[model samples]
Target: MKACLILLLLAAVLPVSAQQLPVDAVKGDYIVGALQLPEAGVLELQSPDGQLLRRQAAPAGESEFRFVALQSGRYRAGLASPQSQGRVWLTEQRPLEAQLPEVAAPEAPLASPKLRALANELGAGTPAFWAAVQASGAPWIEPIPDHPQSWQVSFLWRGDASTRSVRLFWPVRQGDQERFARLPGTDVWHYSVRLPSGTRLAYQLAPDVPQLKGAGRQAQRRAILARVQADPLNLRRWAAGTPALGGFDNIQAEHSLLELPGAPPEPWLEPRAEVPRGRVEHLRFQSQQLGNERRLTVYLPAQKSAEALPLLLLFDEDAYVTRVPTTTILDNLIASGRIPPLMAVLVGNPTRESRSEELPCNPRFADMMAGELLPWLAARYPVTREAGRTVVAGSSYGGLASAWLALRHPERFGRVLSLSGSFWWAPARPPGFVAGGLDDAAEGEWLTRQYVAAPRSDVVFYLSPGLLERSAPSDGPGILETNRHLRDVLMARGQRVIYREFAGGHDYVNWRSELAEGLIALLGAP
Candidate 1:
């Protein structure tokens, strides 16, 4: 009774955190959900600007997750898991740029006048789309609802000054957007479009621009058109924009035209050999440093590469290699031209035998990649030698490892892909919550101190979490707290972070879906 009273008195005497509203302003639609982790540990979340929001804890026993409910914005997340040994920076959850899906509809029109206006503007008959695209500087999209069997098209053009016969693209519905058609023999060039019926496609209108300042090619086009093509079950054999014997390929409508110069920060994937092979190379290697070297496998592509290729190294080797088999996804994406061709190195975590040590912030284990493994493979294949060419990736603890590589050895890794980063700062609080009277103000301060000193970098962060978690009912800073805490830290450091949360529990399905888009956002698209 005396001890209880003394504790109560201590709590009463401590300073109170300024009262803020609960995460009440947040709606599920606004939340970026689906935070799953490997080891259940405590985490603290923050805003992009470092404001303490909500808090949650993920213990070590189960793979529970904690997500943050933040205002819609670009934010980064970090994870520092707790251990009897010490608190180590594990993974910094990638940031969440949670764009609501409804926003996509408004963005879909190409611009505003309305759907009909958008359609008309691109010959799909929409002026709103034209106006919006023109005003926003977004790409032109052709809305093609009527021509189910016909290809969609949006033609934003730059006319040739010399009025020479300039080769042009053949626009079509559901055609690729990543390719360009060069004019044949300087004659009047006409791009063709072919597609099957009942197929829906979104299209972009682009001008044939100069190649390496070449003077021979002249052009004509303006306010490039955004076109769409759809047909009523026409079932065409091929949607070939490129004519036979031509050097170019179809620029599918879904593909983006421009790719950034440098590799994406993290959580973004560039290209991978998307076609999974019939026989998986179920290989395993033991890391002397990592202890039980779990199943570290590789998926070799059947399609040959002229030169050695870049690699997609996935953390969380178990689930990602098994259930999702990111390698398989890469193979398919590469074959479809949705993404580029690259190899996959699915690195599993250390066994429960040594997981606690290997996944944490240990520079020794990091050496394995930089010193021995990465270079050994590079010697054999034609892989990118630049740091930017390499993508250090994983989820949960794997997420921590990816981000850590960038910070610990920037010379070695260009980007990191962390999902549901386990920033395990203890914000022992309750659900649907914010930092409570904390039981004490000093507790929050201590957490701030712990986070302020961790290693970090300009690596891109892809983070997502479940909106809730399984922790003591009285614990503060559940999901919201952890997300907010890290979001603030990365943003303050001026790191490129994409923080998001989903309304789901900690599981593989959520991670699989989140990480799938993560590849595109990190490498596939960016």
Candidate 2:
């Protein structure tokens, strides 16, 4: 009783403010708050990366602020005062309150003519009209009711009338095609189309065709391709530095991702209070084959035991560690007993060229892993050496490498997790083509054909691809179709495979959850 009282007294005397600010909000809505400052001061809204999105000065006593049309992500709203710091989440639209000084008198600001005109056009007070208008562009993705197969995608082309029209360069079932759409209103242009469930797609906005600058027609086309950009408003973006993985040649390009209804939910993606977290040890690995050092981020379970644990080998270690919350996911899974205590070795590629060369069915790379890396890891850590207990996994080209490694040395890697594997790779193509090139060989399932012809291994396979993915070339089908073909071939050959179609493009945003699922399915016990 004495200790409880002392704690209560300490809490009461602590300098930290007891009041919590409102944090939850919907992606498409507004969050209104008032901050009481030193008379009048500057308030700033910042992105998670500290980019200043908006800054305004208001009279000190009490000033009102509204975070309007926020994307689905976390943001920080702050002033110069240390006590006023607060975080907000836009995914779960909830009410929030600010800890500001009491207002003396509230002032109603005059509405702009554009807003007033918009209100008049949509019958100001009608909720449905307001909601529809609010969702009219690219970052604002909404499902159209009564048409279960269709979704409305909006893009705001804020450029002048001379901008011609905006086009979405995306893949469709009939073949890769560019759909040109006009702006219905002042700035927003929208497109509604039917897509299969559980489709993940990445797209860019091609607005304003540029004039050819001292180049031929081909150069002009290349320039136009370079101008394609990810949706500015869509915060759920793909990882950088792995361009051409999505079939685009522009290294500077960023593609926006979209998840249709069927995408699997990864509840373990977030940290849970009751779940015990794991320890991540970073190490530098010197590869004899590559003749350079690479980084490896390893995840070890919270509860260590004398028994060796199954090992999960991942490619693009840096992205998994920084972008996807792999450790958190593992913690939740292990805590809930959904998966056994396992070790994850995320091996990073030294360079873009090296990653492409090594990961895509490179026998020399496979030989190095079998001869050097795996043995080194096994000797150092309490890891299972049984082929069935060792899992090799990766995304895109890395994914191709995982399967190839498993197929070549089934005695070492008995399980394979291929997320959007590049089964379309052909030996006839150039080195750069390994990133995005699809060939006529075996209808874009070249590797799958090779696997079918060869003797089947006892390895288990998990293949995941986005449904919205179309065939890369105009002559062939997209990655999704190729993956399905691979699945069929693998199954027909009597190889065990788990095939799933997620509502995502060829990006980690979708693969992160699939990775979790693959681990649980392969290594977890009921």
By TM-score, who's the top model here? 2
Question: Model 1: runs farther than 4 Å from truth?
Answer: 1-279, 286-294, 425-458, 469-472
Which 10 consecutive residues of model 2 have the lowest summed lDDT?
91-100
Against the true structure, candidate 2 has what lDDT? 0.63
TM-scores for every candidate against the unseen true structure: 0.42, 0.66
lDDT of 1 by residue, 371-469 (tens): 766876677556766675567776555665676666667777876666655444323443222222223432443333443676555466666665432
TM-score of 1: 0.42
Residue 62 displacement (Å), model 1: 17
Model 2: how far residue 394 lies from native, Å: 0.9
Can you write out model 2's per-residue Cα lDDT over 110-139, one digit (the tens) per residue?
123333465568754355544654465344
